[model samples]
Target: MIVTELRFENYRNLKNNTIVPAENVNVIYGENAQGKTNLIEAIWLFCGGHSFRGSKENEMIAFDNKYFRLGMNFFSGGREQSADIAFGQNRKQIWINGVERSSSSYLTEVFSAVVFSPEHLNLIKRGPNIRRRFIDAAICQHRIRYASLLSKYQQIINQRNALLKDIRKHSELKDTLAIWDDSLITVGAMIMKERYDYLKMLREPAKTYHHGISAEKETLDIEYQSTTKTDENDDFGTLTGKLRAAFDASQREDFYTGYTSVGPHRDDLDFKINGISVRRFGSQGQQRSTVLSLKLSEAELLYQKNEERPVILLDDVLSELDNSRQDFLLNKVEAYQVFVTCCEESNKVQLKNGKVFYIENGVVK
Candidate 1:
């Protein structure tokens, strides 16, 4: 998808203005705290997901303003389309193609995008929750139903945890734990299967990108660490059985801790560089490259599955990289419509051919 026009009003610190970006690459450069990243966040909201920066809906409005509105005109599914978001008085309204919608989820079917920011550079260095979130979000891009599945699994976990806590006090209620276990095993197994399959597909493209980024000096690997045994020969039924066994084994522990512990929620992804754990030993550059590779691979997989290219958003992620790495990034993104935000005017020179815009105090000049 390509965004042809973007309009904003009272959104963050950005001035009420409209921007028409180029079809290929657009480099947005400006000084620090001048709303370069805010522009990227605006486009990302069209994806129907929450702010990648984790800002609440009320927090997105400008100071002293009760609401914020973002609109975009884009080409998707072989036609021009438009979407709008208006948030105020603790209410959010969404519209696509001039038709009103009840929820933002409808926007995902119309627009898809992959975003990379400095916070993602810590994907390899951070805890397992971040890695799990990355994998889950990538899967949701293509598998829309997976999002509901995740919600169901989390609900099951919460209910099961409550039961376990009650079982701790009422010994007679222990028998009912079996029902929650059965539900957890069923939903948790499906979640694990989806996650495992996505990580498996992500491995190859991620490896190729990492190899090119490293100039073939190092190899990258991704392994899905599941709570249940996930051998290559295991199928969905086998996975279910293994999860059931795991839940049975952890029954006492679950009651003692008053939480469900053995499920997809406790799983993680392990990134390795040359057979060494990237989280424990990879350099800063390696961590950054690894995240970029995963992100690019996500875009590739989305295109492969849907036959539509998702917009790429790079939010101030080029500062710490060397010239060669920067060149690789620019070259790799040449095939897609990408928006790159930077703090230096010279960064726009790196893009051999593209549009350039400058932002000063929230106004694009």
Candidate 2:
């Protein structure tokens, strides 16, 4: 699927405007804080992604403006489609075509986007939560049910944690913890299964891309260690039973810790070159290649699962890569729609037939 058009009003420093992106590749360049990334953010939002900059909805509104709107026209599944989103400090709503949808779940149904930003370089160097978020965000877009189960599991964890804390004052709360445990196991098990399954599918593609980008000098391996025995092919019913047993064993310890300690919340995705971890021992180049491999793997996985290539959002992601690696990425992604952002005009992304846009003080030309 490719974005055919984008329009936004009162968004950041950007003036009210409508844009028609290139069918294949587009490069957006400007000085820092000149709204280059803002353009990419608008497209990413239209593709159903939250701000890679982590800005709040209010921050997206223009100065002195209380509301912002983002709209997009795209071609997906052999037809034209559109998505419109309205944003405010306290409220946000999305509409697919002209009909309003209940939630953002409909966003993924119409379009898919895979994003890469400079911050993702820390995917390996960062803590487990970052990796977990990487998996959650990517998988949620592919499977809406994964998002639902993951959200339910998170709510169950929060409520269960609060109950654990309250147990200090009301000992009777201990009896009801089992209720949350059941829900947690039921939902958390599904989350773990989906994560494990996606990671498994991602492994071969990531390894191959890492091999190509690294010039065949290094081998990439990813292992998903879920809270349960996810490596095994146990059915859902059997997995639920195991979750129950694990939670039952951890009940007393969880009560004392005032948190739900055993679930997907604590899961980790391990990255290795040969047999050593890229996290602690890998060099800077290794880490960069690792993240790149993971990203390309993400795009391929999305295509394999959805049968459509996702739009690639490179939010200043190439600065971290060497010229050779950058060339490798551009070549590999030539068949897909891409948006690349750069701070300098000399940005080396070779998009011969691609449209180049210059942004200055919020204006694009």
TM-score of each: 0.90, 0.81
lDDT of 2 by residue, 110-134 (tens): 8888777777877898899999999
In candidate 1 the C-alpha lDDT for residue 360 amounts to 97
- At residue 163, what lDDT does model 2 achieve? 95
Clashes of 2: 0
Give the 10-residue window scoring lowest on summed lDDT in candidate 2.
344-353
Number of the predicted model whose TM-score against the real structure is largest: 1
Candidate 2 clashing pairs?
Answer: none
The whole-model lDDT of each prediction reads: 0.87, 0.82
Q: lDDT by residue for model 1 over 184-301, one digit each (tens)?
A: 8788878887887887799999999988877788789998877766653478899999988888888878888998887789888889999998888988888888888888899999
Q: Give the lDDT of residue 65 in candidate 2.
A: 92
